[model samples]
Target: MTTGTARTVKVLVADDHPVVLDGVTLALQRTSWLDVVGYARTGRDAIAAAARLQPDIVLLDLRMPDMLGPETTAGLLAGTPSLKVILFTAYPDHAAVEAALAAGAHGVVVKDVERADLVDAIRKVVNGERGVTAGIETDAGAVTARHGLGGRGITRREYDILRRVAMGQTNPEIADALGLTRNTVKTYLQRLMEKLGARNRVEALARAHELGLL
Candidate 1:
């Protein structure tokens, strides 16, 4: 998914609705930095198009005909670990967000997102950062608490790190902010994940928020 330094970012858009697919594809193409490489109307088509197009980023719809968001994301990453995926959905439920992130999706964006925000999400994920759309953290907190998954306490430092993560800081960015080495920050993230029983930063931060640790 790495492009030449001079090349525009290539993107593949997948949505079940034709209007959505066309609109998003056109929106992305309007940006000078982004190039729309392909479009898919189903999860099966998404996986196949991704394998063939090998785009820098994939804007995937959460609910699709064949495979769901997580399954499609997993398939894409399985074929190319370097590819970035940002799940898109109008529903925006906590379980869907959690599942998508757990399946290795780089981010999640609500379908109603502004064009600029959507573009930002694509850019962020391609840069190895995670995108958590509006209302997700709040929803996650509610879901985590409702499921009784928020009783555990995390260390102060872990709480600090998770807060930074919720603020959308990447590992290296967090390391610099906290004056820690990047590897140490990585280790902390691993420990934090284990402590929170989270598969990714989004889940860890959300769970921590639900526990009132952040």
Candidate 2:
């Protein structure tokens, strides 16, 4: 229940996959207070739509045929300074999640989440809360990187995996070092990908290398 402003949250859904976009749009529409203002099949389209629609939030998919994740996110922010962007993906990995938050995304969402929870997250952002996924818990006090960028704080465990991930650690190797089951390591990597706004682990690693984070 919302107060008198009708308080409709306008959103743009950006994803290259038609099935995912359609499913998300349908799910979002089920929330009475939210509206789909536009749709984008690529990152460039997303940025342009955000500028034109000036929507309150953008549900962005990290991998697009035309533009990559971080670059697309930067473009969206540059175009619509007031817009809140959420990286929506099926995969979630710590490094990826950390990268997205670092790249200026307000938060990240796993497309695999229950629909109601996803709707709740959308509302949270509309109400001016940082709707970071419970899975991407960010702590700003953990890193000693240059510039001492507190906002780039990812969990220590995640940081460790990112290093191994950089050195090309296999899932089994990562599991051994992190004391995690192979399946657990995979889940964490998927979470990281979502956080980093990366469509896949390869993409996430590539972006990390480019940012000199590796």
Candidate 3:
């Protein structure tokens, strides 16, 4: 929560999708604590909007057609020194996550996040706390272990597969559930097993659970 004297968090939302932009803007508008100051559909527009609006936070999408991933995050931050940025994404890759942290983003939130959580993240960022919405863990050290930033991190997809495996789902079952081919599941399993230094699925699950990756 913000101090009583503090102004509402002025927000600039940047996403190429109109529906997403409208939904986010409307949700923020519904909250008295947040003020939707502007909207941008591209990274260039976002940077311009940040400079013009001087917003307290920028709700950004990781994959913009014009400017992709961490580069957009870095650009926005560099241009607006006081701006706090929260990445909104469905596909959170390890490299992008590391780059975002390194570039001083305040948070990384998935796109399907609840409105309350989104509001909380905005408030947290405004108050100088790192905002991490659901599914994505906040432990930087743990993240480092998983995502070494050189194609080393156990990806979100891998973690998903591991969770399914922990539930005793066979490769075929997991494939059906995740909309992946069995061969693809097997490949991911093999790669994750190597990453975890596990001999097999059982050991992999054990290692993942121990590391809090499940």
Candidate 4:
């Protein structure tokens, strides 16, 4: 005996490009086991649709006018409590890929792939398989340490913040966990940014990975 979910997958299509959205939506709609629950043309809209639809998978584009893929990914995970997202990108940089996975995107598809890869990626994510990009170790922290991604000598508290942020914990959660005020957490985040040469939390996380502190 097995669950019906083993056969069917529900999908949400989100992209800044109308043509890509329409194409993916139409392609998925053709399958008996797949349904296109909603289409979104912006990161904010994607979060809204995913929250309402609670689809099994979300096809997310990286470059949106309103938000980049990393921020959009964080928004999706923040908004939709039950949806899994798969990043869709023309560029597959290690930084972007790592950010997406840390932000809870289950997989990534380069834009040039044939439609079949998209369909199959949806199925894989629905089956509770994290479709990781090749060569990334699951142990981001250990990898980071081994590679000496540490810089400017992060303090223990900063280390705590970096670890939590890399694990996808928001500032509020980090604050609560560390028994610090949210403002304090924000300050620590800023300190980490300057020390690591990162522009923001996402950049910091990626930089950590690059230096092997991930």
Candidate 5:
């Protein structure tokens, strides 16, 4: 499934399970725009293959030998700043997923996600969209505690807006991207700033980074 031009998207898939690796690779290979360049069974191997292959995107499993999704995501991004990562998990562990997101994962998708949704998510993420989660329920309390947020915790909406702000998106752009009114975006931004004890967008992002919520 593709739109517009015929540009090919090189992809590297990393999964410990051979069955899963093969299934995902074959499925993605069926898509005209996606090229499955390589596969890895461990986080370290994924990192190595990503560096060697230089794929545009990495479909990484949430649990792998040597390292978890968040750690691997951080390592991959540190090595290849231009690579997009999508965390693929059988279980929707909110804390872990939030950590991966904070570590700069482009999106998270359940293992059972529909092919169409997965394709859409990759496309959206490649288009610079953040917080692309599919078939996973986010727990605000779990994410708050994971990042050491006490007494005050941000809601899902606030977190979404915060990520967009960190990406340097304007309020109007955020509103359009999230399908929300500008006033609603403003309200969420205000609440996020208060929760982070920041006076402005820049300060809020700084505080969020200090708190490990970004």
Candidate 6:
């Protein structure tokens, strides 16, 4: 929550899909602590609305017309540094989610998330906690238990690199995308492979799939 007095958390919902936009707006409006302030169909519209409405949080869709969630998140944060963003997506792609988080999103929730879970996540984020998937583990211990990684869990950065590898991106491309040097990317890749007990990228990806990391 922002400093000062306690008050309703104003939210702006942005989604290209009309059904989802309306449904989410209505659902959020039912919460006494949250007020749905506005709606937007495109990322540009979202940015404009956030500026005009000065909402406390923006429930942004992952894939919007004109801009992606992470880009929109960056724009919103640049304009209003105090505003929080929670990404709403049907596809929880590890790379995309990590990219959005890196862009300053407070949390990521799946589209099919239960109303209670969504509300809890929103409240948690507003209360200064990192939001996570509804039924997924966000901590290292839980991740290790779920993935059976022998007490070693894959990190966000490693998962990002792993996802890129699964997408068939070259190391240089991954480095450029992540703003890392080629050598740094190589080092991270090597470390991730070792964690996965794989000899190369192909084997690493296979191991990741077996562990449901990909």
Among these predicted structures, which one has the highest TM-score? 5
**Model 1, position 179: C-alpha lDDT score:** 98
TM-score of each: 0.62, 0.62, 0.64, 0.61, 0.64, 0.63
So what's the TM-score on candidate 3? 0.64
Q: lDDT per residue, candidate 6, 10-50, as tens digits? A: 99999999999888987887777889999999988999999
Query: Candidate 4 — worst ten consecutive residues by lDDT sum?
Result: 132-141
lDDT of 3 by residue, 1-214 (tens): 4524457678999999999988898878878878898999887899889999999889888767665545577778788888988888775544455556666777777778788778877777777787455446564435644554234467757766765686578999999978999999999999999999999988987876565443
lDDT of 5 by residue, 1-214 (tens): 5644578888999999999988888778778898899999998899999999999899999767666677789889988889999988875554346667778898888889888778887887777878787776664226436544334578767876776686678999999978999999999999989888999998997987776554
Candidate lDDT (C-alpha), each: 0.73, 0.71, 0.75, 0.71, 0.80, 0.78
Lowest summed lDDT across 10 adjacent residues in model 5 is found at 140-149
The total of clashing pairs for model 5 equals 0
Cα lDDT tens digits, model 2, 117-183, are 7777776666776735623334421322322223355454665576567656799998996699999
Off by over 4 Å in 4: 1-7, 133-214
Candidate 1 lDDT over 69-94, as tens digits, reads 66688888988777888888775653
Candidate 6, residue 14: how far the Cα is off, in Å? 0.8
User: How many Å off is the CA of 10 in candidate 3?
Assistant: 0.5
Number of clashing residue pairs in every model? 0, 12, 2, 6, 0, 0
Candidates sorted on lDDT, descending? 5, 6, 3, 1, 4, 2
Per lDDT, the best of the predicted structures is 5
Q: Output the better candidate (2/3) by lDDT.
A: 3
Give the Cα-based TM-score of candidate 1 against the true structure.
Answer: 0.62
* CA lDDT for candidate 6: 0.78
Clashing pairs in 4: 140-214, 141-214, 144-212, 144-213, 144-214, 149-211
